[model samples]
Target: MSDNSRLLRRLFDERVRDLGLTAAQARLLLSLDHFPDQNQCFHADRLEIEPITLTRIADRMEEAGWLERRSDPADRRARILHLTGKSRDIVDKLQSTVEHLFEDTLRGLSATERDTLGKLLDRIGENLARAREQEPVHG
Candidate 1:
């Protein structure tokens, strides 16, 4: 899985280089695009990254004018994330690149095979989540 992830990242990076985005940055932007109303902490949880790391990324992206952070009206302590015009301009192209990559990667798989693989991966993910939940905490 790690190998596959690395390969996909490599391909993604190659494709998005013209947009001046690293794979991680692109992922962050994509996440914000999908869940515009969420705060940075929520995004960190969804991205499975440490909050500080996501904050750092958010800092850089904000500096670059790719996104903005606004205080949530319902929760003053939380900040909602939104894409900037620059990010909005490129998001559709980024999504297209990702879809193309997926299609290329799954080119030879039959529909049934792809469906089976998806189900198996989902089950594996559930098992991993269960294992993590059952793990004993260390102090």
Candidate 2:
């Protein structure tokens, strides 16, 4: 699974390089598009990355006019992340690229195989989440 993830990430990076984005940057944009108006901390957790790391990627993105971090109305200290018009325009292209990548990757798999694979992956995710919840706090 790790090998497959690395290969898919490499392919995605190659595809997005033409759009002037790194894999991390592209992922941030895609995540925001799908789950819009979330704060930076939410995005960090969703991406399974450190908050500082997300902030760095977001800083670059913000400078590139891809997104904005506006102060949350409900919480003066929290900054809500939002995709800019420029990023929104590119999201459709990015999403299509992802769809094409998945289509190519699953080309030889039969419908049943694909369904089984999906279910198995979902189970793995659930198991991992359950294990995480059961673990003792490090502190």
Candidate 3:
């Protein structure tokens, strides 16, 4: 699964190369699209990356006019990420690129196979989530 993920990511990177985004950046942008107005800490957790790392990536995206960080109303210390007009404009293109990539990747699979794969992946995700929830708390 890890090998397949890496290969898919590589293919996605190649497809989006002309759009001037790395797979990480594209992932960040897409994640924000799905779950908006989240703080850096939240995004870092969702992306499974260090807060400092997300900060650095956000810094670049901010400079590029793709997104902005605003002080959260509930917590001034926390900065919520928001997509900019520039990013919103290109989001469709990004999504379409992803769809195309998936189409290519799953080209050989039958519809039933695709449905089964999706369900299995969802089950795995749910199992992982349950495992995380059951982990012992540490100080």
Candidate 4:
């Protein structure tokens, strides 16, 4: 837990909350933006989240109009999640603010330093992801 990104996320969450979106709703929306090309089906196995937990989260998002769960066209009965217009603008604003905050935070860093930090951060994130993948999911 040496990672300090939680503070950044908290700030982002506050901003989103002010705009009428819960943190989870905002994240679900951003996740959609992350895979703009992919249709509703997110590979639950690849996300390293427990299927049950992800299902609940997705269900909540769907309930809030942030997204909808529908049968995958290629595999009917397999639920695929998709974002709706309800969350689109709020998500866009959150993303823009995140980008601006990132740029502002790294404003003083030289290009080489930024590159190095990016590489290091990516490595650290991969390590964390791997660790999380190994942890048993508890209901």
Question: How much is the lDDT of residue 130 in candidate 2?
Answer: 100
* Residue lDDT tens for model 4, 22-132: 776666677777875343336345454566767877787778777877666777667767778887787788898778778876889999999999999999999998999
Predicted structure with the largest lDDT when compared to the true one: 3
Q: Which candidate is the best by TM-score?
A: 2
- lDDT score, residue 67, model 2? 96
Model 3: residues with Cα > 4 Å off, grouped in runs: 135-139
Model 1 global lDDT (CA atoms, 0 to 1): 0.90
Clash tally, candidates in order: 0, 0, 0, 0
RMSD of 1: 1.6
Per-residue alpha-carbon lDDT of candidate 2 for residues 1-139, written as tens digits (9 for 90 to 100): 8999999989999999887788888889999998887899889998889999999999988998999999988888889999999888788889989999999999999999999999999999999999999999987
Each candidate: what lDDT? 0.90, 0.91, 0.91, 0.74
Tell me how candidate 3 scores on lDDT.
0.91
lDDT measured at residue 35 in model 1 versus the true structure, 0 to 100: 83
Could you give me the TM-score of model 1 versus the true structure?
0.89
Superposition error at 16 for model 4 (Å):
1.8
Native-referenced Cα lDDT, model 4: 0.74
lDDT score at residue 110, model 4, on the 0-100 scale: 99
Off by over 4 Å in 2: none
Model 4 residue runs over 4 Å out of place are 1-3, 36-50, 126-139
Instruction: Tell me which residue pairs clash in candidate 1.
Output: none
Question: Model 3 — which ten-residue stretch has the worst lDDT?
Answer: 15-24
lDDT of 4 at 31: 76
